[model samples]
Target: MSEQAQQTSNSYRSGPDERGHFGIYGGRYVAETLMPLILSVEKAYKDIEDDPSFWSEFYTLARDYIGRPSPLYLAQAMTKHLGGAKIYFKRDELNHTGAHKINNCLGQILLAKRMGKTRIIAETGAGQHGVATATVCALFDMPCTIFMGATDIERQKPNVFRMKLLGADIRAVTSGAGTLKDAMNEALRDWVSHVDDTFYIIGTAAGPHPYPAMVRDFQSVIGNEVREQITEREGRLPDTLIACIGGGSNAIGLFHPFLDDPGVAMIGVEAAGYGLDTGQHAASLSGGKPGVLHGNRTYLLQNEDGQITEAHSISAGLDYPGIGPEHSWLHDSGRVSYAAVTDDEALEAFQLCSKIEGIIPALEPSHALAHVMKIAPDLPADHVLVMNMCGRGDKDIFTVADKLGVTL
Candidate 1:
């Protein structure tokens, strides 16, 4: 694509300018104390970003350890039911640790090791990232500490157990609604205090400069593999791509490689807890305005006074007040369309996917599935739609059961 076409098409192939601003959405907005460390991280990551040996190790780990090339399977049952678009699932849920989180974890752990960091720290909402971080830390023989919201720890007990089993020290964050945002706050405090030895592995594509770009690059493996697999299967790119947007790691992963493919449309689903009008949803792009949070300027769920508000979602993973800056940029540039789904809608889609595809998807992607269920039936039968089933439902069974009033 020519430079003019790239710029006009909103392909956004080049982004996060030298100072880390993604069209004013992403930048290193940090305290002086954390600036040096963040710059060090940026330098370390940039050094390896082009290193063949670094990628070789990352690829080897992704294939042998985390299980790469997650399949893109056509969901025939879902397609027939929708009777319009042929739905295909990018099955990253089958990956090690049962989520796409491990992909970035492996990449960052390798970076941490290269930096001679001896301790690993991370913040998680749904616990998937925590478990992924703990798993890599265990593999690398590094001491791991995970900060999780107390409410998340309660609702996502299975993941909590998994993180503990992986030998991680789980710290419950009890501030500000006791959810992902609070957990991130605690993790940042820990990192700032222990900058000498701790490497903070942020779960999502949001954070300071290198983090959003770094996590998105690591997770882009999902999109890279999708491009190859779908080309082999359909002989061309799909008509549209769909994925849930929490901190947008999975969605960005699946969307990045296809950014320049103007023919392929992209959609990101956010948790619209009750509804956008209810003031209880987490649909950041849909209901939020841009503001600085977690060291980056992005669309944030904040009140008129600029205080961040608690986000509501059935899935703990999607209950975040802000999104990754890249997602904010994409939304603003109109490169990617953003939509919202309600808790009930996601739950219904969750059960429908379970019954039809025999895949019990984690609630996060179920939000995407909800949108797919809505639009697929309206599109042409020949139309193709790909959705990222980013994580398995095993960790969410208890929460689902409680909502359904079932004894697990």
Candidate 2:
């Protein structure tokens, strides 16, 4: 094992230190020009970190605007079918803007408002984050620009339309296989250029310093809610927690609050587009080695020369070559298990969920469901497994239709 991986910690929650590193995985590695901006953001977050008023305002919006305490619904039909673990779905998909992305967006926009930022820019893979950012920009009357890969824009047309309808300028990035990495690269370039009045609200739990940690803090509402709701319902913590990972915001959000709980096991599912052996998957932790990308050190899919390779997945959101640094730390620390689900498995789970549970899940969370299908049947019936239903499927109908050979 690497020296960093062998290191032990007393608390999983105490991370990123003051320098924003979770062991060796996370740190600020941006250009010198962006260093001041990064520090400014870190200071801003630290200033409000202990402020109850900020949290009060945040929770107020979460409850009144974004709809908090999303249901922890037992998947009775699915549970019976699987005949092993009693499945529960954390219905984050029911939140406004139709995904968990808004949870982080709401928090970041509030931060931006506090920082007196007049404009917002963000990068998106599936366009859910763009829609959420646009929704908040409209609410707060800020001009929003979203960087999206050209490939993703075409695949996630519905979300692109949603972003436009909400008054966001969509910049289609055509570099680097036209996926999430390219979108993020363009967004970073934009941030470096427009540092005066613009705040780049990164959509995921990757990127430099405060971003991975900040995004996780905002998203932790998922795990916090699950803890309260599950204890109320089952009188105990769950056995396993599952969520699909792109940049790992949703998974980290759902897993962070449970990191110290010894009884709770977490699984993060990566998008294995094809088989891992075929070199077409996005399973960074499973298939890639540690590397620095988009500012933080993390597991990234790269070629022998250290050039990043294109990641392929049917789900636009999971089409990234790197994972969040925190996830990389958790993987190395053995606190959480990482698994990969392929396009076919995710597609099957999507249809199965729609047909069996009467809930149409977005392609992102279908990866988690596919893993649930794999292990749920082998465990005891009393095993309580909760999977984050991170998004709704409305934005992915066209993509699914094409894959299934059906006309929309």
User: Superposing all C-alpha atoms, what RMSD in Å does each candidate have to the true structure?
Assistant: 2.0, 1.3
lDDT of each: 0.93, 0.94
Q: Pick the candidate with the highest TM-score.
A: 2
Q: How accurate is candidate 2 locally (lDDT)?
A: 0.94
Worst 10 residues of 2 by lDDT: 1-10
- How do the residues 210-271 of candidate 1 rate in per-residue lDDT, one tens digit apiece? 99999999999999999999889999999999999989999999999999888999999999
Q: Which residue ranges in model 1 land beyond 4 Å of their true spot?
A: 1-11
Give the per-residue lDDT digits (tens) of candidate 2, residues 1-408: 255553346778888787878888889889898999999999899988999999999999999999997999999999999999999999999999999999999999999999999999999999999999999999999999999999999888888999999999999999978888999999999999999999999999999999999999999999999999999999999999999999999999999999989899999999999878899999999999999999999999999999999999999999999999999999998999999999999999999999999999999999999999999999999899999999999888898999999997
Per-prediction TM-score: 0.97, 0.98
> What's the residue-level lDDT of 119 in candidate 1?
98
How many angstroms is residue 1 displaced in model 2 relative to the true structure, after the best TM-score fit? 9.3
| Model 1 score (lDDT) | 0.93
Between which residue pairs do clashes occur in model 1? Answer: none
